[model samples]
Target: MNRQNKISPFLIIVACGLVLLYLHGCTRVRPLPGPAKPPTKAPAKKTEKPRPYKVMGKWYQPLPHARGFKQKGIASWYGKKFHGRKTSNGEIYNMYGVTAAHKTLPLGTYVRVRNLKNNKKIDVRINDRGPFVRGRIIDLSYGAAKKMGIVGAGTAPVEVTALGRPMAGKSAAATVPAYMPVDFYSGNFTIQVGAFSNPDNAEKLKRKLSRIYKNAHVVNDLHEKTAPFKVRVGACSTLDQAAKYETRLIQNGFPDAFIIAE
Candidate 1:
């Protein structure tokens, strides 16, 4: 009719170009499915808290007041050279456990050790700190100094009397104390490397161990109101010259030195 009206406009322009290529393949833009992968965050769990620690230039400080803490002095033992190691609260040192070591008590605090020259009592637990030398005050754990006979007098004249917290799964020798009353005190000899509730940090570790220790003093414990200064370093008159300056202050780093007959 005009060629069938030009073939009806070329079949209506090929059905409007196949409906615009099927509406451009249903509005194709398919690049939006690549942003849904962000869910991975879980790693945070560490809580250990129990601070304050320094060994040779001394800084201690770990006492949440282990109730009724008593004391007398001089008692030492620590077999097999610190047996299976790792103590001072991280346990593991089982020199035949009954455990003990207290520069400022409170690791587990369970003392009773009364070998005041043979009244022999035993029940230890403290866990570790030391007899950093200076009138020694408890360290035993070669099986509590061989059950308080003081392992053949390596040192004894004990008395430490704090029996505060320890019951669950008992057996610090079941809190032994059938009888324990012996008290005597006589002191001389020093090497205590540090103790302080800040007397200028015990005179800044008694002026840095009095420049290589000759007598680095600082003693002042009018009965501690929290660590009462102390810091001593020498004055050995014997106890084998304070055990040869506590084995040269524990080979010069003072791994908790010893020999404090004062």
Candidate 2:
């Protein structure tokens, strides 16, 4: 009986090892998580596209590109009359913004306008449609006009030069010129060769041009008493055809020939 009651040393060591393994397994627990991360949000995208619209019973389409575009004409500005209104681009008109209105320029084109009277120069972004009167070309915001000293005169003769599209970001837009996209819409078109206030002279030009081309006519604006009668040549089905006629007219004699939508 005394020999059976005594335990082996190997058995005692094995029992102690099993007890330790059980305790180690019981103590093992999942690790605690750290701080949570904030959820991220995505940015909103803005789209710019060319759209045709009508004003005063007339239709106008924006140009696809302003590359190498230059014009000399009357420039006017709007203050309270058009301020707070929606521009052609869908942006609110801010009289204080360095922006402008052009009848045919692309909505986002950047142009340099110089006042011929004072030689004051200002860079403006085209964002709206214009000084719709015949002789006028562009309409400026109050701030732009002020910068160019045209606010006091109400109107000024100016030279506008296309600077092309700006860079991707607003900060770098003025410094870098980007891509020039051409989006031409082909339809019935003509080239205006000359304009005269006197109907007789306009008729004379029309008769002379009619002998050379199948379609040559005088367009007289009946609404405006002071508006000039315009003499145009050729009847083109596409803008490309009108452009070809424009080149021919320019080469022949008419240096001021330009395409006009019919």
TM-scores, in order shown? 0.25, 0.52
Lowest-lDDT window of 10 residues in candidate 1? 178-187
Give me candidate 1's TM-score against the actual structure. 0.25
Each model's lDDT: 0.70, 0.80
lDDT of 2 by residue, 1-262 (tens): 4656779899999999999999999999878997788767677675434444557755455555445677899999998988899998899999999999998887777788999999999888889888788899999999999999989889999999887665555463446445443334455677778778899999998999988887899988564466369788888867668778988988998877777765
Instruction: Find the candidate with the highest TM-score and give its number.
Output: 2
Q: How many clashing residue pairs are found in candidate 1?
A: 3
Query: How well does candidate 2 score on lDDT at residue 194?
Result: 76
Reference-based lDDT, residue 197, model 2: 84
Q: Which ranges in model 1 have alpha carbons more than 4 Å from their true place?
A: 1-11, 14-18, 21-23, 27-29, 35-192, 199-201, 206-210, 213-247, 250-262
Candidate 2: Cα lDDT at 255? 74
